[model samples]
Target: MKKLALAALVAVVPFAQAFDDKDEAIAYRQSVFSLVATHFGEMGAMVKGDKAFDAAAFQYRADSLAALSKMPLEGFLYPGADQGDTKAKAAVWENTDEFKKRLAKFQSDAADLAKSAQSGDLGSIKPAFMKAAKNCKACHSDFKNR
Candidate 1:
């Protein structure tokens, strides 16, 4: 009976492993996009609010935002090749060069934001944040599903 149980366990492990891998990939993608949205929202708050500026908080979040863009875009490659939860439009594949250009723009803008945040100047931060936000919005509007 022990041998039979062991055999059964071995048989089920591969399926479980596959499921876990898929789940992890999905979660990672969700995390990336969620962080992007969250940081963007924070920038909006800082710019729109009259509250005192927090340089530390801004720098921390800006650094995170910049680091996120550096991650391999492999998440953009889905297993089934279906759209799934991706808001990425078909044009992303069709107009590959344009998509790449937009992604590069976003990276550049985020890097600039990070540099500006490091300067500890609220006035500089505002414009940098605006530039980053514009790149993000433009990419989403052009390539994202909705």
Candidate 2:
């Protein structure tokens, strides 16, 4: 089973390895954001004690989330036309400056969460995570299609 899983991951890695064009870049960024969501959800569960807390796992996920935080905005800056299905609304392109500002704030919050999580203090993690998550909510509320 492990080998099968590894094989599947290997198969998918190539497609995710590079941003080929505007469409591909947008898709790639969206994929990275999905990973960010997954990691953050796992960490949130641990922090709230919905799951057993593992400091190492929380830190790892925090770090992964932080790394992915830096990705999505690059897609917003894609040079050419968009060709993929995106939940991003036209407002993202129209208010490009504001979108960039929002992304920058999210990145800052994500980094802070990562640093706090890395300290291995569960108490600090909750507030930091919440603050960072609000950035996501704000962006989605303004710029994403529902």
- The candidate maximizing TM-score is 2
Candidate lDDT values, in order:
0.74, 0.82
Candidate 1 backbone clash number: 1
What are the per-residue Cα lDDT tens digits for candidate 1 across 1-146?
99999999976764322223444555565678799889777867877775567888889889888978754254544453234555567887678788777778888888999999998888889999999998888888987776
The TM-score that candidate 1 achieves is 0.75
Q: List the residue pairs that clash in candidate 1.
A: 87-145
In model 2, what lDDT does residue 43 have? 85
The residue-level lDDT of candidate 2 at 32 comes to 82
For model 2, what is the alpha-carbon lDDT of residue 87? 82
